[model samples]
Target: MPGWLEVVIRSFVSLVILFTVSKIFIRKSFTQVTYFEFVCGIVIGAILALGSINLQIPIAYPIMGLLIWGFIPYFMGWLSIKSETFRNLAYGRGIPIIKDGKVLEDNMKQQRYSSDELLKQLRSKNVFQVADVEFAVLETSGDISVLLKKDYQPVTPKDMGIKVAPIKEPETVIMDGKILDEPLATIGKNRQWLEMELEKIGVAIENVYLGQVDSYGQLTVDLFDDKLKVPSPQQLPLLLANIKKCQADLEAFALQTNNPTAKAMYEKNADEMMVVLEKVEPYLKQ
Candidate 1:
């Protein structure tokens, strides 16, 4: 065989072997890979490259090298899962770098993590001030996890004792101006309903670049033409306003009525409407 032809054949074989070996290994993002795994990847790629171009060396040698590099780590990973000691040895435990708003100099020194490095990592987590950090941990993957002090943390609805409806993932009913029937069905809607919604907004189906129907049965659309402004869906907000108006009218009727029984009935109905508004305001406001 000619030299180029042999190289091509060898390269193809190497590619297949490398892909198979990679499939056998645990899947992890580049940032999440352990130190040993990183080294193994580098060595495997080197072997594959050498085997692909160097015609003098037998392809079997590189194949053997790839298997050794791949299987050893795979076996070690299995062992790590079964034994905590081995797991710690393979991938070290997370160290607490910050506790009670104070940086632990001793632990930082043990990890050989410098002050500037710590600050840089903290900044990456959007924490500019060390005093605001209640706890910070350095993971084996070299990523920092931070928790802000209660006073520094953003207040959630639960913190204010307000109940909110659980949000579900929105279904994409249209993509690239094409209607998707399955997603429409998933949201318990049909093509005719979608058409009616688009008509209400004065937007044609073909003009929509993407459309998603959220859990509250609101259809939000992005038009293909960025310059063209599409009005937002006012179904929820309009319903809310109408309910408020009804409640206000009831209150007014209660005050205007001279009959004691009628006044009591208006006041009771107004109070009930107020409760209903409170329950639905969160869903509608969004």
Candidate 2:
């Protein structure tokens, strides 16, 4: 084989092999997109490129190098979890940038952040005046986490003495026009119910881009074309929601009450509610 052809073939083959090996060691996360991970990714890419193009370099060396690069940090990550000192050393603790409506110049200097950069971060968080900030911490992820002064903070229901219940994360019912079984099963629902709800809204199953059931059991649907108004039945979601609430109440009551007879009754009633929900699920509006 010609020298040029050998390089070409070797490069292609090496990239594939090295990338496969790298994937075994690397796990991705949102936080991992930070500066450290970005540099780590670039180093791995460079190693793969060198291993692929340079026939002079031993393939085992670059492959091993990639593994070492991956392993050391992984080991450190494990150590960080086990030891607070290691965690603080590897990923420095969040430095206080602002407190009591005053910027901490010393902490900013410690983080090597300039006043301009600090102002930019503050602006990004919608704080124009430093006086408005009660507390701010420069996180290890290079993002500035801020808290506004009590007077500057947005008023909540509690501030006004109004009571409100906590809400759970919204569950996805459908994605890419396909009903999600696992999420539906979570809230005591199934595909049939999803289809029925879609029909009630005059939306074809394929027309929906996404659907979610919120904590209040409200169904929100996003169609492929919003211009095509979907007259989704308000009652269908409401009825299903009521059933879910009833089942939840029964289950909670069963768990809390020590009476075996009452517990059995509650469990049985919850199961019956589930059955009724399934029965009512088939009726879809044309």
Candidate 3:
């Protein structure tokens, strides 16, 4: 048999066998891949080619080797869906990176993620500091899920005894210093109506940063230069008192066990209250 012809036949046979084996064996137990499986794929491809073409070197069997290499992970993904153990085996179980609002340094080192990396992830979730997290889980995909300290989270209508309403997308009336005529039309408005509303707020169209119409057709105006100043030293004591009062109220609410959802809400709020205390560090001592 010609060497070239033998290589061609071996390549074809290797592809068929690799695809068949990958489909049958590899696709059942893994959602994520591990380092060991990757290396095994290369070795398996080489052996299959060696037996088929009687190749002296792996380079002579490049085409089939590459095909088999890609098949391993693809096949493993199929298997992983059907079996939980295989999925867990390929991807490590979720680990706790944070518990009870404290950093788990040991877990961080085990995962080989730096404090800086963890902090950055926290920041993306609008958590500026570590003290704002109640629990953090490092998932199998290396992503983290964060539960915010309750006080720091926005108040749901239910928290304030306000009736919960379905979420509705707000329509933009203006963006980038230009009136969104089409969106305004969709909300049954024209440019003239927007200008009149801007005048009512003592703002010109150019001065508005953003303006949106909610489902109730209520116009909410946001200004570009809106800046909230930190409370003066004289105001700090009052602010702290307000926060403490809120915390106590939440604790009391949580004690009302008749309503499970309200209890959980108050409990979560109580946890968040601690975060608020930590945030106003200077006021605490004073």
Q: What's the TM-score of every candidate structure?
A: 0.89, 0.69, 0.39
Rank by lDDT (best first): 1, 2, 3
Model 2 misplaced regions, further than 4 Å: 1-38, 231-286
Quality of model 2 by C-alpha lDDT: 0.78
Predictions in order: lDDT: 0.92, 0.78, 0.73
Highest lDDT against the true fold, candidate: 1
- The clash number for model 2 is 2
lDDT tens digits, residue span 1-286, model 2: 6768867876776677656755765566667455676777778779878877787887678778777776766676778889999889778788899999888888878778999999999999889999999889988888899999999999997899754556689999889988888898899877777777666667777778989986655577888897876554366556667777888999899999999999999999989987876666543111
lDDT winner between 1 and 3, please give it.
Answer: 1
Which residue pairs of candidate 1 clash?
A: none
lDDT of 3 at 63: 48
lDDT of 1 by residue, 99-155 (tens): 999999999999999999999998887889999999999999888999999999999
What local lDDT does model 1 show for residue 257? Answer: 100
Q: What's the TM for model 1?
A: 0.89
Give Cα distance to truth, residue 195, candidate 3, Å: 26
Q: Give lDDT tens digits, candidate 3, residues 1-286.
A: 6888878877787678777767765643453445656576768866775766666665445545655666666666777778889978876688899988899999999989888889888888888878888899988656689998788788876798644335479999887667888899998988888887676666777766778877655566777777822222233456778888889889988886779998998999888997877666443333
